[model samples]
Target chain A: MKSYFVLIFVAVFMPVAMLAYSIVPKRLRGYVLLVFSYAFLMIMSGRPVVYLVAATLITYVTGLTMGHFQARRDAQLAEVKKGKKAIKEACKRTNRWVMVAGILLNLGMLFALNYLGFFAQVGSGLLSLFGIDKTFEPPLWIAPMGISFYTLMAVSYLVDVYRETVKPDRNLGRLALYLSFFPHIMEGPIARYSEIAQGTWEGNPINRQNLYTGFMRIAVGFAKKLIVADRLNLFVDPVFDDFSLVNGGIIALAAVLYTIQLYCDFSGCMDVAIGLGCIFNVSYPENFRQPFFSLTTSEFWQRWHITLGSWFKDYVYYPVSLSKRVKRLTTMARKRFGNKYGPLLVSSIALFCVWFLNGLWHGAGSQYLFFGMYYFVLIWLGGLIDPLARSLATKYGIDRDSKPYRLMRRVRTLLFVFVGELFFRANDLPSGLAMFKRIFTHFSLETILNGKIFNIGMDPADFIIAGIFIALVFARDYAYEHDHNLLAMISGKNAVIRWAAWIAIVMAVVIFGAYGHGYIPVDPMYAQF
Target chain B: MRDQIIEILEDINPDADYETCTTLIDDRYLDSLSMVSLVAELEDTFDITIPAVEVTANNFNSVDAITKLVERLVEEDED
Candidate 1:
């Protein structure tokens, strides 16, 4: 199930159609792109094509209806501006039902599809009380690939349109393309209308620069996926699969390895999406900026899943922070409890809920819930108590910004991130909690040096590979962070050198990548999004 | 208007000043989160809807740049 051919077909066709879209008349661009989107969906889904079509239809109808309503409102607003003033709120009230309906329809489809397992258990429990002990499970749990993803796109579009941040797409065809942009259908950087409405449907000619960059990026992404992510998975699978046999030392090592693997896996897919966007000459936000180099959990979050964080901030944090209740609570806390601690305390509770919600967004499990709260607690405690530590350090006359303090903070941050990730990577809450216990109580350094983990599925050679790759990753970041012109340096070289470097990168993937080695090639994890 | 914009910028990024901070969007001095807040503030302060097209790097470069951008957008609406 490579599903590889769909990508091959798509790589050839998408940009050509986009070029065709550029020359096409205004009326047909939307329709042509829409057909392409559906065709793209059909090829990817192969056997179960109807679900994506239905999703596309649902979004199309909702967008059209929203557009229709928006057109009516705009007309009304224009009239009012033309001396036929009427209260807009009354008109808004009249159309509010449709908006509410659109939100529910999109959200309902998402939960029903993604959370079928959760509902099945609940349904089974309710029936068991009356002796209906038998269970009902879906014969096919074929969640439309990217159902979660497209569902988010639909919601974001509907919500943005409702907020009038963007006007609804009057044409249904453009709306379908927006919902089912093939590159982003499975995993996402979840482009907003404001991000891409101009280029995505604006009928821009696909330029060579965009095409070259796009495939180059996709090539890099494929290399990361087949080489780095799958290669690392060889080390992680055996360790997690048999936790009892592995010592705490190996478990910790595995967690650290898995953490990087997860990042590489997730970010590698993002490169694919961004590359796809590049081909279309549409800009998608960069979702990863070397997250492994992040110095703190908060910094790690800012770098990792950048879009998800921003999404939560926009959709959840701003609204909650601006709400009258939160505002009043903060104001009162500042006034009554003193400005130093009060508002900070109240915001943490809100922050906790937001993190917890963010965690649960990944999946519906107690483990995710714990993963969310773990951040809530750590970030909260860090915010509230960090000042005291800083103050004490000041009293002792140790420069807080001194190298030792910085090193300590860095170490503490790694521990915080590692432990939080322990819970995140764990199979369940109890498992996560048990792992944490073992790390603290039963920690040992001997096993790592003894090569216990290396003997599993990963060879000693794998460690050498990981070491070289990790060093390169760090060097890449160092160049980026320090603003060294590595890209320019390579490109500035003589033609032969540049070409050689490019070919070497390409050849590395063709030769050493984990695929075609008689081992099952694992898909990038973020594809589940 | 430029002074008011500068005051707002100073609240968010204290190192900012009108002349040095005008190329805000291009320089990536203000992130998207701050961009949203800046938009909200400009909307309330100027009583205008800053169209999406006006949020480009050129128009949102500095306090003076943003004020001029806002002035043009609002004037267009007035016409």
Candidate 2:
């Protein structure tokens, strides 16, 4: 059910919907997208559509209520000029209650569906530790697909309305479409209400150029998913499944491969989603910007999962950092320490909460939590070292911007990222520790030469093909990093060149892509989160 | 007011030329960290609260905008 074939079917169905949309009234086009989006959700998620609808209804009501309170407060302020403060206070209190209610309800639904079982197990484990053993068999709840994604979208939408950044969409259906757009329902760019509301409402007709670019983008996504990521997965899954059996070299190789597989899989899905949106003239935000090229763990995060990073920064980081208590803490620290250390202390506290929640957001696992802390420490250390490193560079007459220094930093960042991903992909915290120990203690060149690397699922030919595809991926990303407009460049070429390029992609996917009768489609990695 | 704002900006990051640079946020002259510090300085100096919603590039891109925001917050407090 998670196959690219189904995605291809949806791809075909969307264009057909647009063809039908062309004949309808211009105003009706938006509803076409809405109808199609819901139909897609129902078809894909089945009973979980209930969760989707419930989330939609909750946000829709919250938005409308907030808007109502805002309007009434403005009128009251205008009429009762003497008690403006009282009126504003009342309105603010009422609006805050509505917003809190909305956030809690949506987050509550997510918790019950996603985290309740994990918590129940934790509770039972705690009981056992206290010699009061209790077996709590958590309810078997069928959580909806994209609950994580849509709930965040819902929260962002409500917050945006509360802030008056954008007016609440009066039309429920358009709002519904914004929440449950099919392309984004898998793994979102977590699009903002302001970013996509008007465009989603308008649903512009499919232009010829958009169609060409969109389909091409989808082709590139398919090649990455099938030709690169899925193949790498063939190698990564087995090694990680039984890390104890593999040699250290193989395990280390597995970490790099897992990183590659994850990047391609997640960003590849983004490509498909963004490309699909383009066909309907709906543009989602970019999620990745050559993250592997980042010179620091912090920069890597900014480039990777660009939407989620910014979402946390805006909703969690900024608010917490600017809160009265944290601001007070900043002043206290500044009085005690100097300017640099005070702000750093404040930012460190905020970063702790962000990373803690970020870890919990990924999953309830200890390893996932460790993964969050791992990067937190790295980024915090990098911040602490910034001034010292600059001074050292100046004293040594070393150019920080020069190629050698930049290259060294990139390598250092990759090393940090690889170790973090190793933990992230491990089965458990203990397993992660064991494999990491093996990597340092038992690693040797003979591990690869012992003919054991090929024993994992992928053969030599698969490795060669995956290697070539990965190289091409890096090359394409490198071009993009240099600001090369690859899609536009291809489009501007002659017909033979364009057709050949498209055909080559299709042929590569068909020939080498990991699919057919025997393969079970590995669900897109970030979708489960 | 502008001179005071520039002084605060320079006190935070002496490298930034807040005198002429308009795209402080856009061009990375004042990143999120500095922006937070700037907001805190302005609030403390002007005796006004700058809400999180008003902390956008439009309100902090230049000394003029920062002065206007402080003035508006002051007017609101008086109101």
Candidate 3:
């Protein structure tokens, strides 16, 4: 019941849902999905389901209102050739206000639920800083599960409609279903309306190929979550929870392991979500693309949690960077600083907004803020030095595209990611800083070499098992990086080979999955976000 | 107009072969900053506003696409 990874979910809930979906007529299958989606949300978050309903209603009304204005504009334009521009502008103005109000109302609900306490504390701290003796108790509110994910989808839906990229759906059920689809409602690939709305609403019969592919993918997810991510939690959690007990070497190892744990846990969940989507004939966008292979922090963002990044890019980056005022500033700066740095200056301003929110979007914690700013600074610095780096490479007769150079860049990017994730995983900002300080100030080879590492929750056997699975994952990612599709290759094989592959994965999870005695099952980490 | 757009693109990023290359944004030949500059140059050169919605890959992915977008925007402006 906690997540799709649970045995009851896999064995009972999914099978029942799939059975119900299949039994229903095709015309009614979409309704089946909607009913199940709402049931899932209600089971997960209870009364907070009202938040989702409110958001859906607001988004639906906003989209329809925008559509109405757009229709009016077109009609007015046809009638008046002389002042058509004025009419168009007037309609655009009205739609823009409607869109803004819609966005703010949804965001305002999200802010009240997820961020009110955090911001209240921040405001109180500012008051005390100014010698005013005022403190407010932070309110405790139960946010709807997947509120963050669904709210973003709702905003994107409204924005897309306002932009005239997609027509407003008159079917309230379809819009609600898109926002509340069970598989991605917990932790999303954050699908856009334009991308998967129709296919999801179609409720196509679960085809044979899709069933096989979806099951195979879900099995891979189980193997990853059970084998690698959960096993590492034994070591990662202890070190992070009580970092002062360990030396710097252990702290550093914890950082790397936590980063791996996060990737496996989150991306494993994505595999399950996307796989479930496949079974239902809905194609969710990918959330990760071998992010460790990225050569820069910017590229890293593009590869990791790709939907969130693109959301910010389309909704935040483009709008802010290309706004009339910013454009005027860019023009003036380009005239002064030239093409290379002028737009960079303005883009950095927008990037700051993207990262700042990106961080807060993860949580209201200051560490999340630091995590966002860490990438913002690194990406900005990367852009700032890019021309210089290129010129230097040219001067030294070095090919940036050469294998060695690219490898080096990837390694550097990975290191930067590890540090960023270290802050991300820390208990809080100060603890994160303290652990980071330990890495350099108190690091000791003796701790790792003296077998002290084994005493911290994970034994030698645990390490070996986790390492083997991690290597398997790396090989899978490696093949994917080179454009080789492992699933496709397996699928293309004869039935015997495919079944064997599938059985092997299921068995791997059964044997190696970290569960039962002496182990605590970690919740899907991103679900907390 | 096509030549002018190509000239603007080349000025932004000379490495691309604007004549036939069509995946400028997809391939990231014109990265975000370059796109910003390209939009500014196109607007300045053609006296057409390049709205953020119009800055999609389909509009800026190729010289022909950019020319088409610019021409349409120009006509809209005149209208």
Candidate 4:
């Protein structure tokens, strides 16, 4: 079947669904969401809906099982006249086993579906090196769309239930709706159970203001995707497809363009998701927060794909760092290396694990792995030099928070992020390295200024249009960075001006958007993950 | 016991008035790292095992809540 994801479909589906959603009774609105979501999934994913249902079932049952054991243990403890420790220990052991089984089952399915092929290829190649020739073919696996997202969400669900931070929802449908919620299924803010579950079930009646805001938000998202990201893809595809032929300037320009493309594409998708949720009065957590304004690599991560980083931090980083083994290692390292560097030893090891998983979670590619390591090294180096930098600033009486210093730090962080995206966008690890080599070795100012950029599928006019849109995006982001809302500003204007502005945005997208003719639709970037 | 819990909170983050800050976790006065350290410290100082479930904000939102949680766990251990 031909893919049903066209611009026209999105334009129609959103309004129609919103209308239907508003017509439903308030209490039944949650089920309307479920029906809409599953319908969307069936249309988009088809057979792979099995994976979503299975993940929901396994996690749902696991949660109930864990909760049941916890209750039994509490009751048993109350009944016992003595030896509560023994009872508690036994319960802990059983719950730990159940948690392990739950995590392993879901993760195993994900690994088998996604990474099994990559591992098989590597394994067979290794075998050939030892004078044994055997061709091993991995089984064909059709992984469900959004497996990365829902799997991570499921793990968080189990962890939250296990930690008793939130009780397991006894209603399987609510849990199902949470996992399969259509707007966020493809690309997620990776919401926590405690954060969004109650609101999902509360099903607040649709409001007129929310409709106006949601439609405006969706229009802005379409403008970003259609006007900026897709148009830039024309140039980015050609340059990245054959990096060896391009000189330093073109590659550098392409790197910068790719970064813009990635941000607009991913964040634009988030806008649609969040805007769709707004219609139902379900405000999902934000995924992006003006990431380009970050002053450090750490701050960059905090602002970029915020949910994923927070998920990794809360679920992976904290657990690993606080575990008894890491605690013991911290003590030993402190004794051996002194207090200053000792704690870093534990942090570095845990950070390594976090990055390793972070890289793998992106996809089954070695380049993705390197992308993770690149940040890990940068963050670690930043940590190592932090005290020295602070001391020097203090000694020199320099205000590090001053405008110039902050600007300088932001520029440095921007370059770091651009370089990381260069690796991430490359075809493979070696090609990324070669591109880096060309960037430094084959530098030429004439190539960029003399109009070589216009030769790559896009004319000068295309660049100008894309450039204008990019500037608009930057201005809006800058305002947003200062916590100013442009939409709200528009709303405060007179009726004629406000209506004119909204009409102008919609018209500009239709007239200048990259879609209508000869435009190849570029899939949303993070949707692949 | 409340004083002891406040001392631990102050040791971790001295800026916030832990005794009266009922929305410590909600307002992000205490982040994940500080919370982890706080949990470890509470367990060590009170000689009570704080299960992962008790890490919720309901039990650690203020010194009073934390004191109550610790006392309950301690009493359970004695039983």
> Candidate 3 on A1-529: residue-level lDDT in tens?
6788788888888999999999999988888998888888776665547888899999999999999999888887788759777787898899999999999999999999899999989999999998998888867887778999999999999989988999999999899899999999999999999888898889799998999899999999988898999999999998999999888989988999999999999999999999999999999999999999998888888889989988998899889899999999999998999877888888888889999999999999999999999989998898889778878888999998899999999999999999999999998999999999999998887878988788999999999999999999999999999999999999999989998999999998998899999889888999888
- Output the worst ten-in-a-row residue range by lDDT, candidate 4 chain A: A1-10
lDDT scores in order: 0.68, 0.84, 0.90, 0.81
lDDT of 2 at A6: 56
* Two-chain complex of model 4, DockQ on C-alpha atoms against the true structure: 0.20
Write model 3 residue lDDT over B1-79, tens digit each, in one string: 9998888888777678999999998776876656777887888888888888898889889999988998999998887
Give the docking tier of candidate 2: acceptable
Order of models, best DockQ first: 3, 2, 4, 1
What TM-score would every model get versus the actual structure?
0.80, 0.94, 0.97, 0.89
Tens-place lDDT digits, model 4, residues A161-233: 8877789889888898898887788889798887777777677877867766776777788788888999999
The docking quality of candidate 3, as DockQ, is 0.64
- Between candidates 1 and 4, the one scoring higher on DockQ is 4
Relative to the unseen true structure, what is the C-alpha lDDT of residue A374 in candidate 1, on a scale of 0 to 100?
83
* 10 residues in a row with least lDDT, candidate 3 chain A: A40-49
lDDT of 3 at A455: 90
**What residue pairs are clashing in model 3?**
none
What part of the reference interface contacts, as a 0 to 1 fraction, does candidate 1 reproduce? 0.00
Q: Which scores better on DockQ, 2 or 3?
A: 3
How many backbone collisions does model 1 have?
Answer: 3
CA RMSD of each candidate after superposition: 5.4, 2.4, 1.5, 3.6
